[model samples]
Target: MEIRVLGIGCARCNELEKRVKDALAELGIAANVEHVTDLKEIAALGVLMTPGLVIDGKVASQGKVPSKDELKKLLGGGK
Candidate 1:
């Protein structure tokens, strides 16, 4: 599965990435988690806000960070 974290390298974005990683580890799921920092690319995804989460090319979360449990639920669907 592919998971992308969209942000301009902000603190919240970093935290969101970390939580995603942690969630994946705890769930024993292997996914390609990428950090997207380019504004143009992010905007192209219809994300006007930073710290967006994308799962398998689908926008999951926008403008805010998701908790570990939430991430687990989102990522767990990959199984």
Candidate 2:
């Protein structure tokens, strides 16, 4: 799976990326995590907020960092 974290290298953005990685690791999923800081690319996603999480080309979360559990759910985990 491909996961993209969109931000301008802010603290929140970095934290979100780390949380995402931890969540994926817990779920045992191998994903490619990328940080998108380019304005043009970020705008193309139509996100007006920083610290956005995009999973497989679809925007999953934005504005703030979500908890690991929330991320796992977003990744389609749990019973």
Query: For each candidate, C-alpha RMSD in Å?
Result: 0.8, 2.1
Worst 10 residues of 2 by lDDT: 70-79
Q: Write the per-residue lDDT of candidate 2 for residues 1-79, one digit (tens) a residue.
A: 8899999999999999999999989998888899999999999998899999999888888898999999999986422
Model 2 score (lDDT): 0.91
The 0-to-1 C-alpha lDDT of every candidate, in the order given, reads 0.92, 0.91
On lDDT, the candidate that comes out on top is 1
lDDT of 1 by residue, 1-79 (tens): 9899999989999999999999999998888999999888899999998899999999999999988998899889866
What are the runs in model 1 whose C-alpha is more than 4 Å off? Answer: none
lDDT of 1: 0.92
Q: What TM-score, over all chains together, does every model reach? A: 0.95, 0.94
